[model samples]
Each structure stands twice: as structure tokens, then as C-alpha cells.
Target chain A: MAVDGRDEMRPEDARIAALYRHATGEMPPERLDSAIRKHARAPKDAVKPQKHTLWRPAWRLPFVAAALAVVCASVVTLLVERDGGRLTVPPETPPPDGGETPPFSVQREPPPFSQSMTDRATVEPRSGRAEDAPTLTRKRAEPPREAEVRKSIPESKARIGERSAAPPDGRVLGAEPSHSSDAPASRGNKTSGGNAPLAYSQPPAPATSTSPDRVTAPPAPRAEDDSLSKALPAPSAEASPAAKPAPAANPRPAPQPESAPAPEAKPAPEAKALARKRLESTPSEPRVPARVSALIAELENEPPARWVERMLALRREDRRQDAEALLAEFKRRFPGERLPASLQQNDE
Target chain B: MLAYGEGDVAAFDELYRRHKGPLYRFLLRQCRDGAIAEELFQDIWTNVIRARRNYAVAARFTTYLYHLAHNRLIDHYRRRAPAALVSYDDEEASTSIEEIAGSAHERPEAAYEARQKAARLLELLQALPTAQREAFVLQHEAGMSIEDIAVVTGVTRETAKSRLRYAMAKLREGMQGWL
Candidate 1:
């Protein structure tokens, strides 16, 4: 071979070249070639390409691990969402087209209290209508301005004056006279005579009338009057022979018109008192004991349904004496009526 | 080469026949032992066969082959005890020029002189340092250019050329009368 001119060959290069030209290393024995050829042909003799791959065994572990990790992550995400009470629907998407709102949406405002009362009136017409008519009358009577004006008045002083002044009008005697006007003439004198003393002896009428005005002024007293009017018919219907007594009692009518003016003059105290009296008198029972009357007066602001619940709560808090007294008064006021299950359970 | 990689046994056989003699001689001269040379030769070709499916023709096949051989030799040297690599310069010089020259007879004398010269040349080649010997062998035996030798041996062209020069100088000094 010719040497590159760039490589300046010493004389030794030419001599070494000449020596190397005549001599090369000995060839490997033929057996080595035979052995190597046999090795190279070994796969061919089997007639199959190698099933093994650099990727196969190595890839399996990583792929399996990745798949398992994906599954585990999915499971954990679902569990966490379920435990947290999160809705499955994505936040960005609108909920499925059911008429109802999605669980995550803000809860709808509760139906109005008046709307619920009207609904109850429709559901149970007998007692509910009677109860609802007075409430509706009360709602209609008190203008919003008058209620706001009443809120500024000292409620306790107003209630005390109404209670103290009520007996002199002889309104308690008039309730009996009104009963006589509705009752039969023969029974009217007898019923009227019996009621006049009872009315005079227990000046509960003034107390009851004063409570309504104290608790709820202009509107509620109007409701109490409507309720009392409604209540008068019930007893007359139960004892029509006593109806003649109502007309005889009606002839001496000092208290009849006074009832309406009493509510307008002291709306809060009279409304509260009237509500308590209406509630007690609506049933066949004629009178509520003084203790029960006081208890009912104390709870004048609370809905009637909650009275039992309050008594039971008092008992549960270990106020045993107060609970027992309240329960006994409730039983006396509502004789022959089934007590609420919660109150009964607590009593046992 | 691509066909050989595709499992064409005949193709591989042709490739083997073309390169085997030079490659075997290359390893044999480097190791200066028959068993080790055969072992290295088999190992290199086995690697070639195994690497076939992934083989891309990036450079000349010979350059690629010698590159693998170069790396294998380095690994072999590392594995051996240091004492095994004591210099063979004195041993090579002990063989006299007259012994290498022999007589001036026609056929037998010529044959005797040829064998003696071959033995002496091998001794000189073995006495050279590993890098220089590799450069000389790749140049003369494999017929690789300086550039190819540099590529195969992982060095600059100038380094490969210098190694070849040093190796040639050493051989010439050892066999001056024969030249």
C-alpha cells in the first residue's frame, strides 16, 4: 500500500514495511472457523428466530406497574369523593336534566309560614279552618305600620293596665250574656246565671284578653275576636237548646262592642290574652286553671305545636319539678285530649 | 449486511468468509496466544450476529467490527494480571539476524528463511506497545486508513499515525538486516 505524503516516512518505515510484506501472523486453525460457523448456524438449525426481546421482559414490569397505579388512583379518587359527599357531576357541567335542582345547588327557600298555614287549613277543614280563619283575620287587621309602632311601646306596662282595667267593664259577665243570647230562653237564664258568677269569680277573661295584646298587638287581637266568634257557634251547635240563652244574654250587651275596641286600643296585650282564651275555650272545656293559663301566657309567642316540645325539653334537662307542673297544667287544660307522644313518653 | 441481519444465513456466511481470516489474525497477533485469539474471534462474531436486528449502517462494516475488537482487547487487558504484560523486547532481540536470514538455497532455504523471518517479524510486532501494535496491525493487516484506524481505536488521526510510525520504527530497528 502507498503511504500518505503528509506522513514524512523515515527510512525505518520503508524497512518495517518490507519486513511486514513478507510476514503476517499465522492463520487460525480451521477448527476455530468450523466452531464459529457452527455457532452462527446454531439458531438456523433450530429454524426459529429468537422469541426473546430486549423490550419484552423489561417492559412488562413497568407497564404492569403503571396499569396498577392508574387503577389504584382511580379507586382512591372515587372513595375520597364519596366520603366527602361531593356530587359526581363535574363542577363545570350542568347537572342532568331532572326537574329537581342538583344536590350541590343552594337549597330552595322554605315555603312561607302563611302559605303553610293555608295549606294546613285546606288539609283539615274542621278545626284547621276555625283556627286559620282567626289567624287570617289577625294577619289582615294589623297594618305593617301599626305593628312597627306597637314594637316601640313598653309591652309589660301596657299588659298590666289592660288586665287591671278589664274587670270594671264587666266583659267577663258579657261573655256569659253573649252565650245566653245564643242559647234557648229557658236554658239562657239558667246557663246565663251559672256563667255570670263563674265569670265574675274568675276574671280570666281580662287576663286572657290582655295576654293577646301583650304578645301580638293590633292584628292578633282581631284574630282572637274572630276566633271567639267562631268558637261561640261550636258550643251552640253542640247544645242548640242552649242557643236561646245566647239571645237573652245578648240583650244586656255592654261587653260585645267593647271586645272590638279593647283589641284596637291595646292590640298587643289584648291579642295575646284573646289567643290564650280562644285556645282554651275552642275545646268543649269551659275554663283553664290559673297555672295552665299562666303557662299558656308564658308561651304566647311560641307556636301552639311547640308547647309540648318545650315541656319535654325542660324535663330532659332535669328540670323535673317545672316539667311536672307544666305537664299537670297541660293535662288539666286539655282534659280528654291525647297528650303528645313525646310528652307522654317523658312522663312515663 | 442488512440481509445477514434479516436472518439470511448464507448472507452471514459470505460476510464471515470475507472478514474471518484478517479478523482472526488481528486478534491472534494482538494476544500472541492461539486459544485466546480463537476465543476473542468467536466472541466478536457472536456479538455481530446478536446485534444484527438492530444494526444500522452508520460507518464501514470493517470500522464497526474493529471498534468492537478494540474495546474487547481493552477489557481483556484489564482482566489479566500486570505481571503477564512484562516487556518482550529482550526476548525478541535474542533471536539473531543470521537465524532470521538462514542460507541462500533455492526452495528449501527460501522456505526456511521465510518461516524464520515470519517468526522474527511476529516477535518484533509483539514487543511493541499495545496501542502502537494495534495501529500497525489495523493499517497493514486490515488495510484501514489513518482516519479509519483513529475511528476504530478511539483516538485522533494524528495519534494513530504517530503510533504506526513508532511501531514501524521499532520493527525496522529489530529487523534491519532482513529489510
Candidate 2:
């Protein structure tokens, strides 16, 4: 046994070490050594790590290639399936229902002129004719006509006459001739803008007969004439060659004086009854034009200056007619509001 | 080790012969049970043979062999009953060096004092703590330095030195009269 620095150890340390050395002389039995030797010589195959066939390089590449091909095929199939299921429609054709109005038809009721004035200052000019066409179509699709306006004047007149005859509160029932007269003009506007060339080819005679009381009402008829005169001129400049002659022939001076006074001789009491019917039937909820409603919703949180900037941008885009109409609608919705100088200049 | 690792059975046989006595004796003394020692002795050798391919000469072959034997002995102690450990401390249950010496000597009167001294030394070793006893045994039987004892027992060299020092001090105190 190797003792560390044994010769230098204290005498007692040497004697104790010697005693342990003598005691350790007791050997392990020879059988234990034989058993160990037997184990050491025995085959060790059972303990050797086995070689796995699947992880061999020769087999790995083919398996990886097949898996990649399957993934690629699945991705291709998914893309093809997604692309195959959509429907395409052309832009120029009207919807299948022949009477269905094209969304851009200018014949729809103009938004209140005041509302459009506000809109003209703030709203961005619509991008181009293609973009403006769809927006205008959707905007004009619904006109803000009262339920009373939708009914025949005689029916509305009779209903109002009954209410007035009752006079529950003794308030004088005076129907403003403006309400009754505005309805037929709205209808005439719808026909003219929606069916354009077809509507223009027909005489203004039918429009006069449809609401004779409106035709006879003096100021209301002039307002209708003024609106048509203002509206017709801008469209005539841009109208197609085929559509150009139609507006000119349709709005000519010949028809105005003849159709203008047809509603003038109608009884004041009947007109009063119609106006009363309109007041009672008109819903209390304020009706905003669909296009303006969307703009207000979008900009309800925006400042007025931002509204003017957007409208000026719209004017610059060559969408002057739409920008003007939007400004007029904006003015009607927010009355007494002053726009920024730049927007006011553009509006003029 | 390198020769054995390269499939030289004779090299392994030479290593086994050289270490088998000290390694088995170390197990026997640590466990104090013949059958358990024999089992652990075989297991340690079997492990060395199985690990031949990975063996490198990082230390002396004796240190490597005894390190394996030291680990096997620990496993044997853990698996055996705790009662068996208590028996290692029981002087009457343990075989004394005097009893082993007495069997070899024919004249009892001539060897009586030597036998008694051997028996006393054995008792002192048995009374030492298991770690001290292991350090002493690894030192005396395997001729391991404090460094090899620490490697075998997985302790620091200072701890192995301390254990061996304590063991020798106790043994010397017990055998002071004989010295």
C-alpha cells in the first residue's frame, strides 16, 4: 500500500498505518475473482447499442422527398379550390331587373342644397368616373320622400281634410303648397336621371299631368324649373353624343309655361289639407341622405376643418358635380356653419 | 485500457488479475457481507468489460477499476436492508482479523497476543464512520492517494485526506498500547 509521506510521519502514525496494513492482508476469496473473470470474458453483444435501419442515410432521403411532395400537392389543391368558387359580373350592364336604377343615375333627388355645400368644402373629390359612378348610384338610390308624398294627393288631402274637420286642438290646418309640389318634382327627377335618354325622349307633358297641383303652384313650379335648369346644363357638357340632344330637347322653353301653371287653380283648402297630411305623416326621425349618412358616420368624430379639407380634395379630382352636391347636402345638415376660406373659394 | 478497448482480451485479463484482489477486498470490507461482495465484485468487472470501448487512460488503471468498484459497493448498500448496515457496526456479528489469523496459526499460545492485537485493530476500523473507513480502505488496499480516494468516493481531495487522517488517528488511539 502507498502511504503518503510515510517515512516523515510521527512514530504513532507509522504504527497505526502498519496495523491497518496487516489487517488488509486478508484476501477476497479466489471464487470472487473467478466469477469476475468469467463475466469479463463473456460475449457483450447484448449490451451493444443496436443500429437502427430507419435512420440510415440510404433510407432517409426518399422518405423526406415523399413527405415534401405530399405537402406541396396539398397546398396546390387548397389554392385551386379557393379560386374556383367566385362569381364575376360586368360593370357597365344594369342589374337584371330592367327598372332597377343604375347606381350613378343623376335623376335621383339631389341632397338638400345646404348639406351639399358643407360636403363640397370637406369631402375629398371622388377618384375618377369609374369610382364616382358606383358611389353616386348607391347615394341616389334612395330619395328622402315623406310617406305622405308617396301617396296620391287626393288620398292625402282627404285624410288631412278629415283631421282638419275634426280640429282636435283648433290649430289652423294649413298645408304648405311646397311639400305637395316637391313630391312630383322628386318623381320627375327620378325618371329623368334613372331612365335618362328614354325618359328625356318622352314629353314633359306626362310630368305636368301626373301632379297638376304642383304644376299650378307658382313658386314651387319655378323652383323645379330653376333646379332643372341648373342641373341640366352641367350634365349636357359631359353627356354622350347620343344623350346630348335628349336633355336639350327635353328641357326646352316650349314645355315650361304650358306645364308650369297647371297646378295654379287648385283650391287653397285642398293644398292646405295635403300639407297638413304631410306634417302629420312625416316621421319625426330626421332623414339624412344615404351618402351623407355614411359621410357623417365616418366623420362624426372628425373636426370641421378636416371635413372641409376632404371636400376640397373631392373638387380637385374632377368630381365637381358630386363635390358640389355633397357640399349642398352638408350645408343642409349642418346649417349656419361656416367653412374654411379655401373650401368656400372652391365652393364658389 | 487502450489495448483492451481495441479488443485485446489478454490485456483485459491482465488488468482484471491485477485489480481483482484489491477491488474485491474493498467491496468485502465496505459491505462486510461475503455474498454481497462477490455479487458486486462480478458486477464491477462486467461494467468495466462492457465499457472497454469508451475507456480512456485519464487516471491510473487501479483508480478507474476501484472507482467502478466503489460505485457498485454504494449501490449494494442502498439495495441491502438497513439492518444489514447496523450489523457491520456489531463487533460480534463481524469477522475479526484475529479470528482470520487464528485459523491460519497452529500454536494458539504463541499467536494469542498477535491475534488479540489484530482483533483490536479490526474493531477500531469497524468503529470508524463509513466514509472514513472507505477512504482508509481505498488508501490501504488499493494504495490510492488522497487524490485517488477523492476520485473514487466523489469527494474533494481535502475531504478524503481529512477522512483518512481521522481514521488513522482513531486506529492509533485504539492501538496505542500495542504500538
By lDDT, the best candidate is 1
lDDT of 2 by residue, A1-348 (tens): 223555246787666667666666655577766676666666565434334443465688899999999999898777544322110111232222342222121112222222221121111111112222323233333232112123334443443344446533221223222322332343343212122222222245543443332221111223333333233343223222313223222221111122222222121333223322322222331443455545544443232334455577777877565566567655543332355566578777
Full-model lDDT for every candidate = 0.51, 0.49
lDDT score for candidate 2 against the true structure: 0.49
Highest TM-score model number: 1
lDDT of 2 at A40: 68
Query: How close is chain B to the truth by TM-score, in each candidate?
Result: 0.84, 0.81
TM value for model 1: 0.39
TM (chain A), candidate 1: 0.21
lDDT tens readout by residue for model 1, B10-103: 8888988888878887898788788988889888988888787789998999999999898888778777899775332323333343443342
Write model 1 residue lDDT over A1-348, tens digit each, in one string.
Answer: 334557676675765666676676466578877877777666743544344454566779898999999999999877654422221111221222322121110111111111122222121111111221333334334244233223423443453345445544223332332333232233321222112221222234442342223221111122343334343443223223323434332332111222322322322333234433433433222344555456545643332224455576777887776677767644432232245556677678
Q: List the TM-score for candidate 2's chain B.
A: 0.81
Off by over 4 Å in 1: A1-3, A8-15, A42-348, B85-111
DockQ of every predicted complex:
0.33, 0.30
